[model samples]
Target: MERQRMSTSEELMHLPWWMVLLEGIAALIIGVLLLTSPGMTTLVLTQVLGFYWLIVGVLALVNLFVDHSLWGWKLCSGILGILAGLVIIRHPLWSTLFIPALVVLVLAVQSLIQGGIKIFEAFRGGGFGAVILGILNILLGVVLLSAPLMAAFVLPLVVGIFALIGGVAAIFGAFRLHNSALRASIQQTPT
Candidate 1:
């Protein structure tokens, strides 16, 4: 007999339900922390980022010895990463302000790019919805770019709100997955 192939979602749903439940719980806790103590929590996470960048930078430079194909790019990235890591680590308070603002700027740039793509698609016959979306994206991008530092201050609260919603949804999805699996198992079992 040929084995049946599972759909992507079916395969994903087969993940142990307990794992999803645990993830939900963790996300919920993080959301609460972020909302309650946005500054402290963000600071702690930024510290972790500092450590990660430092390690990755060191590794990149060391990797140069093993692979010399892109020496220039690797060297440049390694040095930049190292400097960024060191600066962030040395000045925690500054990093908390600078990092978020930098990220907002990047997001603004991304929004602009995406908006341009949407408009291009609209011209190629994607309809008015795409054009409207494109316009909104451009507007938002401009707004963000105009006040990245101000947006940075609100970033944590926004993230916290998203986390809380995601956590709650994940918790519900986990239970649904568990029930679905239980029903599937029951159907498969021989009497």
Candidate 2:
């Protein structure tokens, strides 16, 4: 018998419904915590991120042995990730302050570049939608640059609200998926 290959979508569909439910539950908890206590939640989440980076760095280095490909990239990334994680973990308060501001600055630069591209595209007949989007992106970039600290401070609240909404959506979707899977299983079973 020849083996069949499963595409990404098919592979995803094969994941157990309960796994999605567990993910939903975790998201819901994190969302509630984020909303109720943004400051503390952000701090804890940052630490978690640091730990995650550390683990990923170690894993990347280990994977170099399993696969000889891209050793240089892996080695550089692993070292950078480990150093960054250690710095963040060792200086939690400083990390908490610096990371958001860094993110804002990076976003501002990205937005400005994206806006320029969009505007250029519009000039090349991309349409009115592109013009509007380009203008909006430029405006956003300016705003982020002008008050990066303020934006950084508000970032947690914004993220919290988004998380809360996404968590609810995920939970509902999980239930729907679970029911659909159940129905499909019943339909396939012999009576």
Candidate 3:
């Protein structure tokens, strides 16, 4: 019997190599720039964050129209994104100073929720990685709360590293998205 072909969405999981390399390079550049001048990074980061929020909000809103099942999540994500973006747009300088603390707070909350979800998934016998990530998040959140000053100082560097890693992963994932045959082979491989 012939193997069933993977769908485009499934293939998207395995992105192309060039895309991954590009993403990695971009992330590395951003990381290096941030590391070299952390003080200046504050203003730049605020602007970037503002734009990111707007983009994400728009994306969420777009998804709401396209996928009704995600209406609740999409609406909340969009509204939050828009609000965050607007705050930055209104007082970018003030926002720059406060963004770090807010970022930590938001991330801490996100980590808690993500960790909880991971723990639940692990209990259901799925995604051990999620559980590990969840634990890491919990630790990170505690560290951020306990040592806010230290966290504020070092958070940018850490964010740079995360961006580099995420970019690389996205690039790699993009390749997977492009390679249907490879995706099938990988999926067929026994875990």
Candidate 4:
């Protein structure tokens, strides 16, 4: 018998359900922390962003070596991410300019990029929810970019709101993953 290849969604379903739950819980906790202490969160967020970019850059570079299909794009993205990460990490004060406006600008650009990716994924069978999230992220980025000064004042609140929404969505996703895993397990069990 020929073995059938699994779709992306099916492959994802094979992931341990507990990991999804943990991720959801972690997001909820971080969201609450950011909401409760925006001032401190801002500083931490900068460092976090730096580390995140660095890690992603490293992963992308590794992926380029592992999968040569999109090596050029991956190489460019990885180099940019690494450079940005290093610059931000080394001169966070310069990046922020001791002003929240700069931070908002950075976040806006990041959101715009992420939103575009999400939108593309949504078109590729990701689901309507992804489209909605992509639109929202793009709108947030546009709003911040359009009025960066104004965005600085409300940056914390806006971030808080988005974080909460993301947390909730993650939680819901966790449940869905759990259900899928349970069903898969049940189906696999012999009578």
Candidate 5:
């Protein structure tokens, strides 16, 4: 029996296109703002980072009590996120300069782990796309980590680039979905 291919919708359900585009657009906007106001960028970045960390931490904390299986990991992540959030709040200036570097470090570590898992999963009959995505993620993380200080200066630009790519991907996916739906409806009509 031939393995069934996943439809565009099915793939996109797990990776929504509009959300990707929105995220990209938001980053692009932020990048533009940062470029126009370099002096204020640090404060803006700090506030954004702090809020983000705080929200994620709160969500993780909630998850810890809501799910028993992931209690340990959730709780740990929650605590760490909260602590990081507080630090950012307390030292916005420092956070603005250092948060990007921290992000790069964390992403680099996470990408390696995620890529390894993807490679292993692919070996065990997962999709080739997963492996490819994993490799790309790892490469991106490595690039971020290689020159974190320099990357920090260009963080907004990097984020904008990522977002733009993601947005384009989302738009393409959306069009694919539109075409598929059109085709399916036409096929279902009486000849």
Candidate 6:
């Protein structure tokens, strides 16, 4: 049987709007909790990350059979993620020491790369805001790299703010999906 590929928007349209709304609400709640209790949030976040990675790994592995293209890289990535997640979940105490270090290092590298891209975009006629954001990203990357341990402590606060923004975006997305579905249904109804 041939597999039918759906466009991103079409796939999204098929999704139940209530599911999106629930996801947004859940993110909002988690964001609020993280912001309110940073210390506890870090541990919780670590555990959640582990579970996320594990689930993603499993999904990716499954997808390897579904989509054979780039299967090698997908398999490797899935296995690595699964192993890392399992190790972290099985040994929370040991994970606490190394996970934070790893997280900060990854964040530092991502910030640096993003900063560079933004700076380049700014030079290519992007707004002043881009330049400012680029500078801030570079500065943050440097600071995080300098004291990664400290950066780990601050990670929860930053993550909370980002999560809040994401939650808001998801809520808006859910409404948009709902409206589109309503319109589609109305159009399909007999006059």
Best by lDDT: 1
Question: Of models 3 and 5, which has the larger TM-score?
Answer: 5
C-alpha local distance difference test of each model: 0.89, 0.84, 0.77, 0.81, 0.74, 0.87
Residues 1-191, candidate 3, lDDT per residue (tens digit)? 13335555444444555666687778877777777787677778788889899889999999999989969989999999988988897888888768787777787777777778878888888777878987887887777677666677777888877877777677666565557556677899999
Once superposed on the true structure, which residue ranges of model 3 sit more than 4 Å away at CA?
Answer: 1-14, 58-77, 106-143, 162-191
Q: On a 0 to 100 scale, what is the lDDT of residue 155 in model 2?
A: 83
Q: Assess candidate 5 and give its TM-score to the true structure.
A: 0.57
lDDT of 6 by residue, 78-173 (tens): 998898789879987667667777889998999999999899999999989999999999998999899998887777778788889989899999
Q: Give the alpha carbon lDDT tens digit for every residue of 26-59 in model 5.
A: 6556656666665476578788779889899999
TM-score (C-alpha, index-matched) for candidate 2: 0.88
Clashing pairs in 6: none
Candidate 2 local lDDT, 37-155, one digit each (tens) = 87788788889888888888888899889998999999998888898889889988888888888999999999999999999999999999999999999999999999999998888
The Cα RMSD in angstroms, rounded to one decimal, for candidate 2 relative to the true structure is 3.9
What are the TM-scores, per candidate, against the unseen true structure?
Answer: 0.83, 0.88, 0.54, 0.56, 0.57, 0.68
* Decreasing lDDT order of the candidates: 1, 6, 2, 4, 3, 5
For candidate 4, the per-residue lDDT at 50 reads 83
Rate residue 173 of model 4 by lDDT: 85
Residue 12 lDDT, candidate 1, scale 0-100: 58
Query: How displaced is residue 37 in candidate 6, in Å?
Result: 2.3
Model 6, position 34, has a per-residue lDDT of: 76
